[model samples]
Target: MYLISGAECFDPSPRGQVDVLVAGGQVIAIVEPGTLNVDAEQIDARGKILVPGLVDALTHPCGGGGEGGFGNRTAEIDVETFVRAGVSAPVGALGTDSIGRSLDVLYGNVMGMRTQGLNAFMLSGAYRVPAPSLTGDIARDIYLVAPVVGVGEVAIADHRGTQPTAQELRRLAAETQLGGILGGEGGTVLVHVGAGDSRLALLREAIEGSDLAPSVLYPTHVNRSTALLDEAADWALRGGFVDITVSTTKELIAAGDITAEQALRRLLEAGAPAEKITMSSDAGGSLPVYVDGELVGLTAASPGSLSDLLRALFADHADLFPLALAAMTRNPASALRLNAAGEIREGTRADLLLLDPAHGVDSLMCGGNWLLRHGEYLN
Candidate 1:
């Protein structure tokens, strides 16, 4: 049992100053300060702000990269890195090199995170058509695999992608929808929007030419280019979710593309619904630089980028900070259909982060256990 006292709570919706009580891995109660009479380990959060633990909807936890070669494959993420990034729950997926890494290994990484006191789930496939799955069938993988909530990081409109046809995409979305219905999961087809000339065209065609709802397709990395960002805003206004990657560098940002903060501002200015936008760190994935169709260099992404983005938004856009925070928390959870997460409420899972005066992660608790305390990793 743990008690967090006198923290300004943001159930991701701002609940003012309150004390939160946790027991048996669930948020059992939240009341006015000094109202709790329970026996538990207490943390003094008088000057801190409490927010729902971040849910990273897209990350290469098992490892991403490989565009440069086998030696360039990124390393798997550790539990400490996630805690430091204020992420209590993260959804793992495979990126460019799914063939070299097995679904079994990805599933094992998910389970390992669970044992380390984090709530983790994974997508079923990689960035290709006929998505590689443990059960060979994407639908079966979702329905039979408890940890698999969707299918994704499937590439489209990119030179690195499989160049799947409209028919192939329609079939994929249909199968994923059926799997979601049967498994009671989100069953989202997480499309990796590329910087190709045909950006988002295939996804739009898939939605229009088929009976699949627009919500069935979730396109990520939409902030990679100005044109793609505009299209993403339009897509969001039309009731689809657009994910912006926070793992960007100055070089990428200088090339006429916007940062995650800028993307949020543009989406809002363009009349896109707040709930339709999400932000994630493409953690442990490769951020490669392609010059004239040749991969010149690669750098690894970190989950820490998510935290940095949050602090930047809070400082630069204080008025819209709450809404931007939702992109990191509530919106992604809603998009992923994760019911018990993304908010601080009684009966929901006790995954929480405490922010210090500098807006850095001071402590983190997942499943009612403190993983980091006073800016230190407890484990």
Candidate 2:
């Protein structure tokens, strides 16, 4: 048992100053400062901020690369990488190299991470049209597999993708919905929006032609281009969700394309509901660079970039803090149906981070176990 005292909490909603009780892998209670007197180890957190640990929804935990070649395949991500980055939950998915990196490998990594004390889940399918599945069907994979919460990271409108038609995407989403209904989870189709000129046209048309709710299709990499970002804003206006890639924004900023801050600002300025937007790190995935339709080079994304982006936002864009925090925490949790995770409230999983004065991770607790203390790793 532990008592975290005198911290400004953000249940991702700014709960002012409070003390949180942790026991048995869950938040036992939240009380006023100095109000709880119990037998527990005392941890003073004066002048610090407490926020929910991040839920990165689009990571490639089993490794995601090989566009350049087999030699260029990125290595698998470690549990410490995410813990140090203040992420307690990481939803794994496959990308372009789904053939080499099977769903079995991804599922294994997810379960392995869980055994090592992380809230890990995974998506089914990849960038291909006929998405590869363990049970030979995506619906069965979601319904039967406990860790398989949703479908995709499915690539659309990209040169490397199988060029699945709008109808095909709709059918895939329907199948995911069916599985979700049976399994009692959100049947979200995590689409990888590419740089192709289609620019979310398929998703919009699918929504128009089908009875699926706009919330079922979640497109990522919406910040890859101005046009796509604009379309994403419109999608959000119509009650759909959009995901911005943290590593992609950083890479684009490095290439002198657009800064991370501006992409989010543009989305908000274009009437995109901030609550409807989410951010993901795409950690361990390949950031493949193409020139005239040829893979020239690539770089693998890392875990800390999501934390880095949040710290930067707190430092440079204070007004976006609440929305940004919710994006990385609560929003993804809700979308993926991660019970008792993502929020720092009583009866929830005790996945919390204490931020130092500089907004960096000072301490981290996942499932009532201390992973980091005083800015040092303990596990």
Candidate 3:
């Protein structure tokens, strides 16, 4: 057992100074400081802030970025990167090049992370209508594959995308939701809304014309353009979840019509529900620079960007810090149906991040084990 004492806890909602107890890879108790006495290892958290470890809903754990060429395919992300990024749960997906990279490879990578003590998951398909599936079917993939939560990073409205019709998307969403229903999880379709004139039209059609719930289609990269961001705000207002991609590269940031910071601000100003918004690093994916609809240069995204973005948000947007934290943690967890995995509370997983006074990650504990301490890796 472990006792994390005298820390300000954010169970994502400010629990004041409290003590949390952990045992057998789960949080067992939470009480007022100095109120609980136990014979267990102690962590002095007097000057720290404890929050739930981040849940990255969109990432490329098996590696992405073959846009430039085969030589430019990014390297697979290591377990150390996820720990350093303070991500306890990461949902991996394929992007533009799902051909060279296969679902089997993605599943292997996710299982590898699990072996290393990370709560890793993956989507079944890539950026195409006829997505590559491990079980030769999307529903079967989600139903039979334990790690697959949904189908996604599927592209739309981009030149590189398959330009799937509304019927195709509706069918995919229906099957995904069915799989989730059968598997007792969120069977979501993670749509990659690209920089095209069609915008979210296809998505809107797919959701509105079908019996599928708005939650069935989770559109990401809504911050790709100011117009798309505005549309995303409307989508959120209508009770749909929208994801903002936090880009680390200057080229990708510039490629977006607005910065992630600006996009968040815009979403709030547009009156979008705080709980319906999420931020992802798009890590390990390609940040390709397109000129005249052609890929001229490419750079790989970093998982560390998730932590960096949260730090920057807390430092600069104090008023929105709580909402921002939820965006990175609880909201995405909820969207991806990661129960008892995103918040710090009794009965929840012991996946926590202890932040220094500067709001930087100082220590990280996942599954009741310390993976990082004093800004250094312990395992």
Candidate 4:
């Protein structure tokens, strides 16, 4: 058992100074400071703040890339990377190079992370249809595979995507929804929105022309372009969720692309519901640069980028910090329908992070086990 005392906790809803109790890898109770006494290791966090561990909704756990060939494939993510980034829960997916990467390998990576004390999940498929699956069918994969909650990172409107038609997308969404219903999981079709000219037209069509709920399709990387961001804001306004990627480079920003923070601000300013917005670190994926329709160079993305963005938001835009935090926390959890995640609540998994005076991660706990303490990896 463990007790965290006198910390300002955000049950993602900001409960003032409180003490949190953890046992059996779950949050057992939360009480006013000094209210409860128990035999447990105690830590005084009077000067710090505590928040639910951030969730990376769209990550390349087994590594992504390969747009530039096998030599360009990204490296697999290690446990320490997630600990340092304050990511306790991560949902993995394949990107452009799904052909080279197997779903089994991705599942292995997720299970490995789980063995190391991180709460992990995955999506089956890459940037195309028919989506690659372990059980040969996307719905069957979701229903039979324990870690698979949905099918995602499927590409659209991108040069690298299969450029699936509206009917194909509708079919994918319908099947994914059915799988979710049958498997008691979120059967989301995680769409990878690209910089192509079509923007979100196909997704719009899929939502309008089908019985699928607007929430069935989750479009990520919406901040890659101004027009796309605008479309994403409108989508959110109309009751859909949108995800902004935090793994953007300065070059992309210079080219008029918005950062995750910028995108969040835009979404809020444009009257989009804050609960409908999410942000994720497209970590371990390749950030390929294109010049005049040619692949010029590729660089790896980091999960820490999401933490960096959050730190900046906390420092510079304190008023927006809760909303931003929600984007990484409650929103993604709700969007993915993940149980006992994205919030620090009793009966939920005890995945939490502590912030020091500098607004950096001072300690992190995953499944009630300390993975990082005082800025050092415990393991």
Top-lDDT candidate index: 4
lDDT tens digits, residues 141-213, model 1?
8888888888899999889888999889989989988888898876888899888988888888888957787
Q: What is the C-alpha lDDT of each candidate?
A: 0.87, 0.85, 0.86, 0.87
Error of 3 at 88 (Å): 0.8
lDDT (Cα, tens digit) per residue for candidate 2, span 117-211: 88888899999888888799888988899888888898877899998887888899999889889888757899998778997988988889689
The segments of candidate 3 whose C-alpha lies over 4 angstroms from its true place after superposition are 288-297
> Which of 1 and 4 is ahead in TM-score?
4
Q: Report residue 329 deviation for candidate 2 (angstroms).
A: 0.5
Candidate 4 stretches with Cα past 4 Å from truth are 288-297
lDDT of 3 by residue, 247-276 (tens): 655555665557777888999999999899
Model 4, global lDDT: 0.87
Better of 2 and 3 by TM-score: 3
Instruction: Report the lDDT of model 3 for residue 195.
Output: 86
Query: Which sequence of candidate numbers ranks them by TM-score, best first?
Result: 4, 3, 1, 2
Measure candidate 1: CA RMSD.
Answer: 2.2
Error of 3 at 310 (Å): 1.9
Q: Summing lDDT over every window of 10 consecutive residues in candidate 1, give the lowest-scoring window.
A: 309-318
TM-score of 4: 0.96
TM-score between candidate 1 and the true structure: 0.95
